[model samples]
Target chain A: MKLSKWALALGIFTSVALLAGCGSGSSNSSDGVTTVKVAWRATGKGDSMYRIYSKKWIADFEKKNPKIKISLQPINASEGDYFSKLDLAMKSADTTPDIVNEDTFILPADAKAGYLEPLDSYVAKWSDWDKFTAALKKGSQGSDGKQYGIPGTTDARGIWTDLVVTKKAGLAADWAPKSWADILTAAKKIKQTQPNVIPFAMGVSTTNGESVSMQTFEQLLYGTGETLYNEKTKKWNVNSKGILATLNFINQIYNKDKTGPSLSVVMSSNYGSTIFQDRIPKNQVGMAMDGIWNTGNWSKDGAAPIANMTKVLAFNLMPTEKGQKPGYVTMAGGWSWALPKNSKNKKAAWTVMKAMNTKQLAVTRALQEGTLTVRDDAAKDPEYLKKPFIKEATQALQNAHFRPKNDLYPKVSIAIQQMVESVAAGRKSPSDAAAKYATDVKGIVGDSNTDTQK
Target chain B: MDASNVIKNKPHKTQQQKTERRLSVWLMLPSMILLLIFFLTPMILTVVFSLTNLSLTGEAASSLHFIGFQNYLQMFKDPALATSIWNTIVFVLFSAVIGQCFFGFLIAFMMRGKNKTFRRIIGLIIIAAWVTPEVVVGFCWVAFLGDNGTLNMLAHNLLGMKPVAWLYTFPMVSIIIANVWRGTAFSMMVFQTALDDIPQEVEEAAVMDGATRWQLVTRITIPMVKGTIATNIMLVTLQTLGVFSLIYTMTGGGPENATSTLPVFMYKQAFVSYQLGYGTAISLVLLLIGALASLLYMKILKVKI
Candidate 1:
């Protein structure tokens, strides 16, 4: 009886192990046709249209290239999860997708990791490459001066204002603030007159991620007559007067004057959604330092419809500290298509990328996703120019600044976000936060890679 | 002539004993191999990675360098690590030690004299939380506790009070409650089974000896179930120490590292920051803590050998 029981247990264990092994069975065909795997972030409120466009692009590419099969791998996740999942997949050759839709900010780090293939050779041969302007072309190049990705869609950030609130504050209907003081004055007036409505919306917490850094902090920092990175020295400007001034400005808005939203609202994870989707359309918020894609939440096809949004809303270039050199400040960020180095079907993947990068697809994607076009031709397209807000946003791009393209940029950006949050929460004075930020950033990116600005 | 026959028989008897010992080892081989593959191998690999500079991307991706003790040294300097360790301890203490064990035992005691139908209904109700996926539980709590969530709406309408962002104001407490809700079911069932197994004669003798209900429970019932309590606490503490999905979904370790427990910290370091070596070191610390908890529980229970 003991022998029979042992045999039965061992038999069951072996069968279970065999079944588990069978569960991972994948069909690998040695057929003539090449299958190119493409992965992209297709989950979110705004990504549905992009998903449809991507599918159509894949279908068109497969049709044009009969020998290559396109597999659409839509990542149903948030931005953070998508990047981690893609990063994991790219670590191994067996699971890495051939073509990946990468955020432009991550290009330098991803490329340095040897996950990306330099596409300079392909871009040189492709005639349509010239359709992208110098700035757009620069967005795709890595720190090593190698073009490793194809820019698809980019967006610029600026000041968005509700004309109704501006008028109520005795500011002009066409309220274009020429300097930092002017913006503050307008906000103060709005607070005094319209006590119930929040005068401005700006994110600063770690939960806000790049939204706080890019839309609010960077805009303010750049306007204070300094840049975060010294381009010539290739070192981060950690201890800069510009950064301190920006922190003070945040402290002013959030803690001192209380013109911005309450700490509870700003600290929440849904601060962005609450600001744009609920507050802006409902006219509960006045001025906001935000991206150009706010209209996507309130358009006729949007999740919520706001009647006559264009008539009620207006936007302008976020002004410099005193409207000094370069006059106004805006920041542009976007996504790109990168070819992974581990991909087997490089040629087929390039074909798919090329098919997706056409002017028509770019324009359609920009229109549906409510992003600024990276291609010069697509930006000037009549259909795209029909939207007045897009025209102003395109104009705002003339003074736009890109983030510091470095491997340690992500860590540095988080430090900046923390600094802003500390000031916003009244936990630290601007000088204190600035000092701590300098120390923290120097710790993250070695001291040798950073410089103290005079 | 008799001695020579005995020596020859002894050699045959020794041969039979040797064969039986060899068969016993063979019978244990499968379990030993499975443990080695599933648990021991990964643990050894984590230790190896912890001694090096290994990251998912950037410089550490293509090249790995052995920087012995460097990852652990850096972890000591990381301010977030201190906060994460404190948060982890608080989580385990509240969620497992006090919340689950005390509340679970309380409910078990309340239902001790109940009928079968009442017991089954209460069991199903509590087990519902235990059986629900962590992610679903997290989402449910988020909806019920968010700023504009169900609780806040109800409070606003009923009390004429301001809405509270419970997760923001008290992230640790909120997560502890959610965890207790999910885990108390296990403790409840275990304690109930243990209570039932106690001999009826001992309890009846105590009752006949003029012992009050409270005295009987304190002096007799708790002492009898001390072993089960220790086991339940050990299991729940270890399980709660590694809760990532529920906490991550609820708060994402923010407003500003307020809710970043060890597992969340490890995840951010390993996946988000791509620092695999540093994250592995944190994982080893977590494993050591779990091992220490088990040992401490065993010692407290005075379980010999």
Candidate 2:
């Protein structure tokens, strides 16, 4: 009896083990078509736009080529966390996605790290390569002179001011500052006229981190003709005269209390969604140094629809230091679609990337999402040109510059942020803060490798 | 004749005994192997990685030279690391020791004979806060305490005052409040169970000897639950030492790294700065801190077990 029972148990265990094996093996090979996984940012599960577009695009591509399948894995984390998680996942070959949506700041870093594959071979064969602007193309080039990713869209930073608030301060309805002094004077006037309303808003807290460094500090620095790193010399510039001046300007704005929101209010990530979605629409803020995409949140499909956005709001070019030639300056950066170095199905991934960068797809995405296209054809398309904000932002982009793409940009940016925060907090004089920043940057980049242009 | 009988008996018993012992060891082997592979291997890898300059930047180092104590030396030189370590120490002392334990014990002591319904409701409320997602909790706190947030709105509209930036001015304090609110329930639950396990007879005997409620708690109840308190302190200290989400979501370790603990700093280095080696080194230091804390607690408790 015991021997028969043991035999029965062994037979059952073997059958169960075989069934498990079959279940695991079913997902491995399916009809000889490899499944390529692609990851991108989506707002949430409730947003059907991404889902619908992805499904239709996949179906169309599959019909054209029946031997490949693409699986879309949409990530819903915030921008920062999404990038961190994506990097973590991409660390291993087995778990890496075939394609990824990368931010402009990270693309160069990832390319330098060998996380991305050089797409020069593919770009050479691609017909649409010539359609991309030279500057936009340069944005995707790594230090090794190889193209790593294809730029999808770019945007410029500008002043988003409330016309009503400007008028309340006796400023012009079409108020546009031609110089840094003009901006400060107007801000002071607004503060005096409407003590209740915040006169100016710029992000300058560590919580805001790179956003503060880019959108606020770099916007000012670039206008002053100061760049974070000198590409020619391949060294970081922390002690530039323009940087000190920019620091002083930030210090005056915050210490003098002539700005829109408090340091804390300006630093919060929700500052964008909340100020634009709730506060600015409610007429609480006078001016915001924000991206061109603010109008996207106030259109008919926006989170808070402002019927009179064009009339009530005004867009202005961010002014250069003294309103010199190239009167107004702006900084532009864009996100790209990159292929992981370890992607199993490179051809299929390349097809999806090509589809994503097509003129039609780019225009549709730009129009639907208010992104500025990197491709010349898409940029000049009637669909994009018809959008008023797009036209204005595109004109502004002519003088736009990008952040120095360096592996140490994130650290350098953090140092810049700390100095900005110190100035905003009234804890240090601008010159002192600038000196400290130079020292800090020198420490990070090493003395031999750094050059501070004073 | 005796020697022959003894040899025969030993041969007869050998196969059965050997089979039984083999089966028993085989039954325990799988679990032992799992513990060694999963738990021990990763820990050893972490230690090894901590000593190397293995960053995510994908640069091939000229050499993987073992520079003994170099990473730790660099940790001391990093301003952010020093600030984070200070913040961690202060946070542990304030939030865990004073906020969670002391206040938790006080509430539990008061509710010892209070209405059961009140106790249950309070317990559920505290647990609810503890169980809420860290991100949601961070958002709620930011909404309540931020500039132009609910608190500022109330201060201006209802109290007729100027708005104050709670998050910017008092970032560490704001996060400490949030951490304390979320973590106090754990201490409460621990103390509650420890109190329940205390013998009623001991308390009754103290009462009969004319001991007051405070005296009974001080002398008898506290001593009985001392071990639980020690364990709770060790656990919560380690947990709080590694808390990244709350501060990241709320302040991003901002207002000049005022609220940055070691974990946040380590994460910013590893992920944001892409300095995996430096970050791993920081993590190793954090692990050492936790271990030292546990050992200190054990020594103080002097628990034989």
Candidate 3:
């Protein structure tokens, strides 16, 4: 009886240990052929369509190099979840993928965390390295002065008008807003004419995360000719005339003019998809201040594809505050192809990463996805400029601003979201919100690190 | 005379001792190991991690240093923390304490001496709601209370009323009601078992006297199941405090963070902002709150052991 009990206990222990052992990572290499693992976001409807391009890129690469096999690690999640999950995965050599479809917004943090490998050595040897514009190249560089990634596509944010509603509202579909007043006037006109449709769709809730900061809030702040971080002073612009003016503009739209979408619709977690796929395509929105990539949303093979794209939507430049020195303004955040530091197949990974960022592929992705090509040559390609919206979006880039590339940026962004969200919710006045923002940012980066402007 | 017999029995005595030792080891081994790995280690690590400036990303992520309760201090200054605590308190009080417990006990009490078929039918419906996944329940409530959902549709068609924005307008009320609906079944089932265990003669004796229904219940039924009531409350309170999925699936702590409870706030901090230390501190505070509530329940109810 004792022997039987001992035997059972040992058997249970062994089975449990074996179960634990089963979690060992799979083989990436076999029979002299390397399998390079690639990680990218392929979750939502519009995002999943990017996989069609990636699949073709993989097939073409495989045909060229039979010894190299690409294994795709598609993460089906929101942007924030993807960032966290990718960081968790890349923390260990056993789980990290070889190639990564990285957002440049988080590249500084990732590089600073030692999760990404510097690709300067690889880029120095590549002939197409110089084809990438200086600004685009700088966007992919880490604070350590190391080239961390190759720019995939950079996008600009602007005003996207729904002609279906523009015509209904008695507004000119072809008109470009030269100032904040122009957009608000158009929004009010739309509001008066079409009571059912949303006058202006802008993300302001924390649920929309960076979409509110970059696409909505920053678009206005950058236009005010104030940088989020002072490049020369090397201190964050905690409170400034530009910030106050920007918050006042947010106040005007959300409170004074009441042109933005209802707080209920704007505050929901799925507002991004709601505005992009439903409101814009369903002709329920008059004017949408959004990123350039929304052009793909209404394409033939996009998320909410409509019959006549040109007839339905019109892209216009986001003009500066009162049409300043740089007349139009836009904020650009580009995605890039990065190599994980813990990648097992380093050589094979570089080959796959290179294939992912070619001149032809960049142009194709830009046209298909309605994002600006990072490469100077690809941007000028006749095939790329075929889309008229793409041409207009490119002009917005002439006065584009990039987010402060630092580790503290992600933390600071939360404070900005809170400050902006509070004002939008009518919980605080614009001046009060800006003052709170200054205090919040001061707490984050310390007193000496912040610069206040009157 | 027994010296030779004593020598002969020595080997058997040793054998018996060895067998008894093996028996205990075999019985306790699996559970002890499981407790160490799953429960103890994680608890200790969470406590340790809550003390550090450990981040999930950036330069701070790679090298975690002890910040000595700085996260705790900083948490006090955060406006979101205050909102989350208030929301959590209101959610727990209404949904669990008053809503679930009250309705569950009422139904269970009402059915105490009722027909067998009636009890089973009610039981089945309640269990069905409980068995459905939390996410499914969330989605169902969202559909039912949504602007163009069944509830609004019925209200519009029947009463000629405009479709009300239920979730957006009243996030807390919406989540609390849905949570009560989902959790009442557990409390009901517990109360049913407890109520059934009460001696029939005791109730008969109470009715034999000149006692009203309310008097009989307050004096007898409640007194008899005091222990079970306390235990049930403790269980449901802790369970409700950790509710993440149901609320996350429905509101996503949205409409400008109005519905963001402690769990939602912790998720935003840890996963979204990648502030692991601050998030861990929030979780620990949440755990303490749970512990404090349990202690309070046990103390007020005077539950023995």
Query: Of the candidates shown, which would achieve the greatest lDDT relative to the real structure?
Result: 3
The parts of candidate 3 lying over 4 Å away from their true place are: A1-12, A15-25, A46-57, B1-18, B158-160
Model 1 agreement with the true structure over A114-165: per-residue lDDT tens digits: 8999999999999999998778778878889899889988888878899998
**lDDT for each residue of candidate 3 in A81-144, tens digit (9 for 90 to 100):** 7888898899889988888888888899889988888988899999989999888899998988
- Per-residue lDDT over B105-126 for candidate 3, one digit per residue giving the tens place of the 0 to 100 score: 9989888889999989988998
Among these predictions, the greatest DockQ belongs to 3
C-alpha displacement of A9 in model 3, angstroms? Answer: 5.8
Residue runs of model 2 more than 4 Å from their true location after superposition? A1-29, A43-54, A207-209, A425-432, B1-24, B58-70, B115-118, B147-161
Which residue pairs of candidate 2 clash?
Answer: A200-A259, A200-A260
Per-candidate TM-score against the hidden true structure:
0.91, 0.89, 0.94
Full-model lDDT for every candidate: 0.83, 0.79, 0.84
Of the two candidates 1 and 2, the one with more favorable lDDT, higher being better, is 1
**Two-chain complex of model 1, DockQ on C-alpha atoms against the true structure:** 0.35
- A341, model 2: CA deviation in Å? 1.5
lDDT of 3 at A39: 86
Q: What is the C-alpha lDDT profile of model 2 across A250-307, one tens digit per residue?
A: 8778886446576666667666666777778888778888888666667666567788
Docking outcome class, model 3? acceptable
lDDT of 2 at A226: 71
